[model samples]
Target: MKITVLGVGGMGSRFALMLHQGGNDVTLVDGWQANIDAIRKDGIQANFNGKPVSAKMPIYSPAEIDQSGVKADLIVVFLKSNQLDAMFKRVQPIIHKDTYVLCLLNGIGHEDVLSKYVAKDHLLLGITMWTAGMTGPGHVELSGDGEVELENFEPAGEAFAKQVVSVFEGAGLNPKYSHDVKYSIWRKACVNGTLNCLCALLDCNIGEFGKTKQAPELLHTIIDEFAAVADKEGVNLDTEEVYNHVAATFTSDIAGHYPSMHQDLVQNHRLTEIEFIDGAVARKGEQYGIATPYCKLLTQMVHVKEQLVGAK
Candidate 1:
């Protein structure tokens, strides 16, 4: 399959490498010039399962492809939410009628924004529990063993969803077709609501946070509030069960890893997804007449930190 991976950051780079290794023709795209230059000079480096390896693939900046017309069967977007608008604008020339666009970003509201730009038939919603990060320029580290779930939007169906899953699964990544990707996204968001923000606020790794005396209680509050909001939105999720499932993963397999929110704060980059995760809960709480004091407070604190750091 001809695939183009847009936003070749941590997860994007890892996906690019996996696809290439599986013998798919893959092209990597990112906005950063240094990372692009590094990948062009040396191969894309991925540290998976504690081993370092490189995948040789063509890397391009958006500018390089702007003048040359190019398209792909599939374009997998791994950008942060803030970058979506610019990515969609730049990829306009290459998006064809049949080009399938799959977004694997965190948080909600992505599908709404994407629908404005692309046809519903061409859009695929997806979520991943796999944890990865960019260790340095041109280097990506893979940390977790969760699968990827994807489903077609209103105009697409199960067959289209299966094709997308098959491509990723063939590349050795666990991929599943979901009839209800909305619930999958919410489930993943529930996990992130507890782990990501808490880890960022406490300045600790997943295991350290789990072991902290206040960790479990704080996590429970966040999960319970989020579950209430999810219920209000008609997405039924068992808060306690999800909490246990996430806690087990954090304590065992992903003990040493820092959540992406923590990494963003440490790097002094702007953290906007907090608005979607905790802020989303807080918003829903207001509508449903539920008080989300904790979520609202954390949302404010993270915003203040972002302003202090001058992140956009």
Candidate 2:
């Protein structure tokens, strides 16, 4: 399969490397010059299960997309929510009518942005629990076991979804087709709303945050807020179940890792996806006359932190 991985950052680099090594023709496109340059000079350096794996695949910046003359059978998007629109537009030339665009991006409102670029029939909405972090330019550290759930939002995309799934499973990506992926997306967002944001705000990894006594009380409140918002949107989120799912990330397996949000707003000194995650919940709650005080406050605090550090 000819695939184009848009936004070759931490998560992007991980999947790109796997798919390429799995014998698919995969090319990468990202906004970061250093990442592209590093991959071009050497190869993407990645560690999986405590073992180092290296592979050479063509990596390009957005400006070089069309000139690469590649028509992608699939476009796996791993972009941050805010950067989706412009980047998707730049990669449009490769998206033919039969091409499937699978978005495994974090947070919400991504399909709204993506729908503007591709037909609903060509759009595949997905959520992945896979955790990957960039070590440096063109380098990533990936560990732990994670799977992805994706679905076709339109009947026209069903066949495409199955085709994509076969390819993913062939690459050992472990994918399942979800008839209702919104629930999964919302559940993952709930995890991000808590672990991703709180860890970023405190400048700590999950282990450090979990060690604090206040973690449970804070988790309860945040999960309640997210549950309320999700309920309003018809996604039934069991607070206790959701809380447990999120708390599992604090174990020794992924405890030392800071989530992608922390890597974005802190390590990389860039803007975050809070607006599309917690902030999105807050907005939906507002529309439905539900109060999301926690999400609203967290969103405000993250924005303030972004301003303090001059994030864009």
Candidate 3:
């Protein structure tokens, strides 16, 4: 399989290396010149399951992709939500009619932008439980295991979606063709909405947040806001069930882990996807006339933190 990965951060680099090692032709594209130059000079460095593994592959900036006229069988997007529109437009030359685009990004409203780039039948929406982090340019920390649940945007894309799933399976990415990926996406959003945001604000890990006395109440209120917004979007999120799923992460293997948002906003001093995650819910709540005070406040607080940290 030919694959092009957008945004070679921790998750993007992890997927690229895995696919490359899995015997697929993988090329990387990112907006970060430092990352591209680092990989170009030293290849990708990873600590996989506490063991070192490294691989070098073709890397390109978005402008380079525009000039190279590179095309792929699959375009795997793992970019930050804020970079989606500009990146997608920049990479348009690679997106041919039959080229499938699989977006495993965290949050909602991605399909709106993606649909403008590809046919509905060629768009595959997905969510992953996998976790990864970048220690530096061209360096990543990949540990633990996670599953991917994805579905085609249109019924006509089923066969190709399964083929893509098979490719993921071969690459050691646990893939499941979900009958209701929207529910899964919403469930994952609930996880990010509570744990990811709170962890960043509180300056703690999942377990640390979970150990707090206010954890349960905070989780309930935020998830209820998300469920109300999701209901308006036609995704029926069971509040208790979704809350349990997210709360389970507190005691799970990644108990000490900070979420991607924290890695971006707090550690890296970079902008986060809060606008797409919690902020998206808040915006939609306004649209649907649903009160989402928790989400609204969290989104505002994340931005305030962004300002304090001088995040771009």
Highest lDDT scorer: 3
Error of 2 at 293 (Å): 0.8
Q: lDDT score of model 3?
A: 0.92
lDDT head-to-head 1 vs 3, winner: 3
Residue 117 of model 1 has an lDDT of 73
Q: Return the top candidate by TM-score.
A: 3
Cα error, candidate 2, residue 267 (Å)? 0.9
CA deviation > 4 Å runs, candidate 3: none
Instruction: Order the candidate numbers by TM-score, best to worst.
Output: 3, 2, 1
Worst 10 residues of 2 by lDDT: 245-254
Worst 10 residues of 1 by lDDT: 263-272
**Candidate 3 residue 179 C-alpha distance from true site, Å:** 0.8
- Residues 1-312 of candidate 3 have per-residue lDDT tens digits of 989999999999888988888899998999999999999998899999999999999899988987886898999999999999989989999888889999999998899999989999999999999989899999999998988889999999999999989988988999999999999898899999999999999999999999999999999999999998898778888899988888898899888888998899889999999998999999999999999999999999999999999999
For residues 1-312, what per-residue lDDT tens digits would candidate 1 score against the true structure? 888999887788888888898889898888888888889989888788889899778877887787655778888988877788877887777778778888888877688778877788888999987778887789889866868888888755557668878888889889988878888788888777778877777778888888878877887888788888888877888877877877786558779988888877755374557877888889889999998998899888888878887776
Better of 2 and 3 by TM-score: 3
